[model samples]
Target: MTKMNHKILLGAAITLASLQQASAVPFAPSDARSMGMGGTGVSSAEVASTVQFNPALLATTREDDHFGLKIPQFSLSVADDGGFIDEAEDFDEESELDTTGQGRTNVDLLSDLLDEATGPLGLEKMQQGIEELKAAQLLPNSAPIAKKTAYDNAATKLTQASEFLDTRLYSRNPSVNGEAGLVVYSGAIADDMDDLNNKALRINGGLNVAGAVPSKKFSMAVHAGAQVTFSGKVKIDPKDTDILRNYSAATSAYLLNIDALQLALTNLDENDSSTFDAVDTAQQAVDNFNYGGAGRPESEGNTAIFVDGELSPEAEDADLDSEIQMIGVAVADVGVTASRVFNIKGHDIAFGITPKLQKISIFDYTQELDSEEEFDSEDFSENQEDYSAFNIDLGAAYQFGAEKQWQAGLVIKNLIGDDYESAEYISSNGVGGAVVSISPMMRAGISHRTSWTKVAFDLDITENDPVAFEDPTQYAAIGGELNVWRIVQLRAGYRANLAGSDQDIMTAGIGISPGPVHLDIGVMANTSDIENEAGIALEFGVEF
Candidate 1:
């Protein structure tokens, strides 16, 4: 049970847990079409899947189908590099222990101990040693005394070392690491490190919008939908007693071979390891000295009764729970549009433009430690309310040739430069630090229809831009979709952050229609990791 073995086990466990949680979704429109390019209807009545992608596209829906739903499985992965130092330390410690064992006088005993420990070498060396010992008849089946003795002694020491190393490597860092700014660290450090490194999930839901729109040429739709996001959080309290800061410090020092402290801790006999004990006791004392009035007595009728019956001013406990709140509408979108057809050289060309308004409300709660009171604030207040923003979408389709067999269209989305502003309380007023996004999108698709099947190909691209709170530059998505039989769709594409980080996505979806009801299911996968996503959408409409 060397540190190396413990770390290897921990790493495997983290990797497996992450794989089990991987899930995916289309972060862009092309992703949706990869499942199936079926949104080209003639009226809003048949445009029921997640309507947010393109409000104007609703006009393409068939007139008879009136309602729709889209439930997509969602997941994500996020990773950070700060915590790997501890894992590396575990590796280094194990290596040192192995070297130390080689220097021992009794190599056989060392080998026996290694065999009992759950590690790479333990299993391999143990098997080899056992075979050799058996071949030499050093201990026959009837004379197991020497063999048993060797096995037990080795097993005991290995077990102890393994247990100690496991506790040290996987446990949370009791003392905060790095500078105390922005990101906070807590929770099971090993697992939390893995969690923060990556995130993936699946969300499913659908949209129901009826009586919200009028016709294909000019209409509006209001959709109601629900989304469940799957993710993980690391909850850590710096006050946990199990966290040994000096142990963390020792491990850190061990990593650097700074032996002053280690030599001091080792010189004392096992019974006099009071230095470590004193360190733990001092930490507990500091943790219990709550300056935040958490455990202080409160005034009853303006009178305070002290523990010793001495009168003192009563202090109220901080309200930890009331600092958070939730309030907001589920879903809403408004739009106005106009469209017309014109004859150009006897060819029919249809074009349209849509103006849209979008509004969002978000609630947040956070506690700031009040050093004077040794507690946190309990007050909760309105955190974010973003004002509406106006965006325009334009599209045009041209029919070609005598039979009008060839058709192509272009769509430009989010044409306006409206920097949606965050609520005053949560504003990021820095240069180029705006809340709204102006994504200029371009999409083109061609479809061929025969008696038995319908096939289509689509390509979509949106330029990248960075958000205020995130990295300075991140790109929108670019992807393609393939559809067949009007029922099956396949998608694939590559997305890259403006910073140059990239990942690939793939997806498949199926559509089933029965009279006025329609059901769509889609699954997505990512190439960079084991992330995947699945979604189901339903719509009810009539063909006019």
Candidate 2:
């Protein structure tokens, strides 16, 4: 196929541009405080973030808190353990330059050689001269000395041509293979395509605003937020690999046929009574030289030179069947939480519930990797599906210890599970359908708290399915916060994926509270392979 510049950001930006509503679908904690503490807010959340963590926190938090407000809490994360981004960037970089240490890009070299081989003064003319020599009539009993001279001339020229091919095309120069860029030989393009197959890039982000009024007797909170998630993957067609690989093989085969004909003419016996028969034998070798059996093997079918003894343009013009499939989900939710504490068996227990309305939009866009099609805002919107639904969250927390410093909590979000179908997009199989399911998410946590120090741990009891085409996640996390005289707080934690499909992360954050206004910043990175995963969150709020 024709070479085209592949700047992968065209696909990346489409997913990132929808960050306004990419949340809640992953159903993971996104607030700065929670994220800093390794997504462990189930039991340790303060009244300010009770709506996002555990609503029961509204009643279970420190008795000194009365009111809390959080406006514009934001967080974003990306994972690319497959090295898809790196590969794309490298390919783009290589495509921009010319004449590396290898003399020229492999494709350019092959293309130019192909043009010359099929030119007016190339292999075809040489072959015609041989045919004319074969067709010359021999006089009765005359020695075919003139015919032998012509044959020798053709053979000598063919030997020179064969040596040129060997030096320029066949010989692997030390510098050529040492270069970093691709050497588009027989299987190089196919190997590159295989490397990209199934590699995925995922991005998720959310923005939220919330307010809460806390009390042991009764508590209430209101939260409105939006989150967006995008996932993109490479889908390669096997036919694309075969076509490209076969084209490269054909070029080599074309050169091989020239050598075969040269050898046949060199061994011909022109002075024999069967001189015509010997010339006929060499002519047959040239005409029937299909150039198979080695390198590519005879069992793999014909790898002959293309149309009418020339490299065919169809090989370069054919459409690549491979495509980059992208899916994005934007969800917005508005919810209200109510919580209360009750004295049961001489101990205080808190319970909370939230009923929420959700608006979800799904975008499914698929395009061939080599396509020149452009996508704009309207095009993206056209590929989206929107839906509205209602959901509920239930939470409970209990405190038991000498001074009630030990607390345990449980939360079940999206109590009534539902599935939303995505907008139709042409799939690789020619069908058009996908489903995003919102299932009940159950998590349990425990925390031990003292005036200035707190440690908490949480575990997801249920695995959350991917909203698009990513791995399902179930996280178990441990985190702690140190409050320095209530002015500045330092937090750190580690989160591990119980499902074992994603990277484990280490998180840290700083929260500065001057008087009642607070600012929180949290950052996280994959414990291993740092470049593959990272996230950051920021939130500003006030609490009393």
Candidate 3:
């Protein structure tokens, strides 16, 4: 009834409706080179593109005039079912009674009879309706005209019940029935009401950056990224049929109370009416039906029936759209290494490690109604901060036999402590820790010193522990590559998930090299789910 109670109810309603926000999950890139095949470059000197894979690899940069760029696209979707109510149904029936033939009923007698029927059970039900109406901001004090209109509508239904119940039940039970009849009638009435509501949402965003390594062993770079998310849903859809049923039950209770009161009034006489006070008592009973506040007041009017009235679908939808953006900076190896021999035996190795700092920003806003048309600001702000952590990677490769026909390599990624702490969100403390990959590779089928073509195969084993972050899994990829005219290379591979969702990744890529510049593009496609996902990546590098 007080302003404080009104605000509390409204806040509770908003909390209950805002439960559909979306959360972000971890992601992985499917490109073989990014996955650590030959180590991301034509040679072992640090290049701009390598910074994205392993920062430690940047330490091996031997070239001063080299630069590279990379662009990638990724997407995912999830399907959810079973949870919360979706629909509501309600119905009402009415008839008129000729109370004119009967002597004037004492309103006092009627009030006593109706009170007996409701007792504690009816009062509890009425209180619940009031609570819901208050939460919706539909209380008489908040929306006076709308509140009054709903109250009158409910009262009119009660008036109609006076005629219907008087005609039907008056002849059957002229005396008081036991509490058993009251309970049965009350329950039956509650079952006819209906109420329904529905909701849904969508989110999207992206990141971008530019930087360079100033020297061979030590290099510095700068990066920037942004994210945008939006969500919205509509009610009154066919899915929300349950809401209607609740309404029908509430209306039925109102009518039943009126009928019971009319019967009691009929039992009182005129002389008793002056002293009996049945009509006055009945009026009080009707006023008590206003469940809008803590205690019944004449000014409150009938608030029970309108308690579950319609809500503004648009206003509700906007409230759900707000979410935070996640931004971060990552450092990795960007150098290149070159082979010294053409055949018999050759060796080259490059390593990189990346330490990252991230910031997550979430914005929340609430709406308050003042005089319907006017509004006032509560508290709103854009707060930005950061989270810091580190991850490391080591990569190496060896070539054997004439024409460097055989090659083998090993890579260790995220090889550090698992937990990362930031201002907005704490990454799982269990340590993103480490992932190990071993690639036993081979190249053959070359004729002579002037041969223009060659073929190669790489078998890899990767241990990905998304689990520390609550997602854990292992994967393997078997792939082969072909070179033509010493200018173009084609690659294809099959990858398999060893833990969690058992799915296969089919991948392919192409590489082009002209003089000192090299370009590589790769595509990975998931074939398991109906809404399959495909990932594409591009990498550029130059050899000095």
Candidate 4:
């Protein structure tokens, strides 16, 4: 695992350094009202939040809503359907290694086995015993019991060492899989590697403040807010799987040599010259046993333990090129909005415009697998690229019906599109960077209103491109609101992806407005997987 993966898994609640989504759908930064109604606000937004959806709504608001002040509003969303985040968080807890004493890992086990097999009391000691037996053969007067004892000791040590290798490195247990029923594999480290293959995670957050004055003749508002996103994915090297899985096969070959040498020892005969030649052959085999040299593996049994002499591929410090890529962005904007209602042939039409200044900061970071260094959130800010630009938004709304209860609205945001490049990183493969794209997006909405009930629907007319690394999105949403004598309100809605890239979302919310002061809260989650996809918004304000 990389340091960035750890930082995101452990410090997610305390830091905003990393977040990700499976799809690149754009998120709205409006108040709880729009969120509760399935993000449908273009045609039915209140005066204080009209600038966030369709500015024309500022002038077309209810006749009694003379003034609106939304001091603070906040929203957050996250998606991780891949289960990457959960796997990372549970890595330590779910590890199969022993935790009672030294907490030995697979690398530690291999190192111990290698040292025992090649150390002073290992092959060298066995060779010394063989030399003693050869001396016994040379001296015809030597006691047969002593010679036999020497042979037994040498053979016993070889047998014990072979058994040790089997227990420690070649053991297996039963396991069941959905696709492949009951089967046995090398087990621990290889299984863990398979679980971590290719997975992604995402997170988003926003905050805003605004104030507006509503009027049919002329309406005005000021809005300011910021939206931040963090996301990443893991990319495992294919070589790691081969290295971990082939250990059993290599060790089995070594065990076979041990068995053959033992048979030659058991058939030893001092009187038979042919037997002498067999013993010599077995001794030669035992003495010439060799384990392959390490660096990068060239074949089976040649797992790369050390890379460039200092770092081990199995250790946390080894750099095996890029294994994970992450991106973070913050977009802040302040805007002044103006709108007016016009009357033509007994019909009411509203038009509005907003001009805003935007500051965008983006961070692109990458890290190799098995890295131990801690990832700092400040790195995102320190290495980010900053860009400043001016943008415009236009909106229009028309009201009709016998009691003027029907309304239709259209909004075009970010008329002047711009693209900014983020920081870059170089690896053995190539250079990589993130592009923060601002593009024009249009949405159309329609609504029907009564004294106590209002229903609205909205549809995206253009597909919006991702700002970082996500999928393009177009949405169709429907929502309804119920007012309880202007005191309490309940809202429910649903949103569907027209592009068929993401899951459908269900939304619900509540509002309290006894007099001039109001408080609202809204929440949303995908219909299928609530744990990986969810959102919440909250706001406090005054309206009349």
User: Which candidate number maximizes lDDT?
Assistant: 2
TM-score of 3: 0.42
Q: Which stretches of model 2 miss by more than 4 angstroms?
A: 1-24, 95-189, 242-246, 262-318, 374-378, 425-433, 468-470
Q: In model 2, what is the error at residue 446, expressed in angstroms?
A: 0.5
Q: Model 3, 1-544: lDDT tens per residue?
A: 1000111111211211212122221223223343222222312212454343333334334344444433332222221111111211111112011135443222222223344423433433444433432332334344545544444444344444444333322323335532222223322322311121222222223333334453433445433333333222222221112212222233344545555444434443433424124434554454454222225343332222223222223211212222112222122222232212112233343333344443433322223211122222222232222334333344443444575444444444444534322222323232321121111121111111114433333332433332111123345445555657647867666655555453556667777878656666666665564223345555554443
Worst 10 residues of 1 by lDDT: 318-327
Q: Which residue pairs of candidate 4 clash?
A: 19-203, 19-230, 19-231, 20-201, 20-202, 20-203, 21-202, 24-471
Reference-based TM-score of each model: 0.45, 0.79, 0.42, 0.76
In order, candidate lDDTs are: 0.34, 0.71, 0.34, 0.68
Candidate no. 2 TM-score: 0.79
Candidate 4 residues 1-544, lDDT tens each?
1111122222221121122322232647657988899989889888788988998989988889999988788889887656666655544343344444665544343444445544545444544555664564454434545655566666676666555544544433313312110011234444544555555566778898999998889999999998887766665566555444554454454456667777876886645557656766776664454332354246644544322311133422223432656677788899999999988777789999999999987777665554555677786676677889999889999988888899999999888887666656322222366666777889999999998999999999998655443455688999999999978999999998877555689999999998999999999998888976789999999998
lDDT of 1 by residue, 156-199 (tens): 44334433333333223436433211011111232333333322
Give me the displacement of residue 482 in model 3, in angstroms: 3.8
Question: Against the true structure, what is every candidate's RMSD?
Answer: 18.6, 5.9, 15.7, 6.9
Q: What is candidate 2's lDDT per residue for 46-67, written digit by digit as tens?
A: 8868888788889987878989
Ordered from best to worst TM-score, the candidate numbers read 2, 4, 1, 3
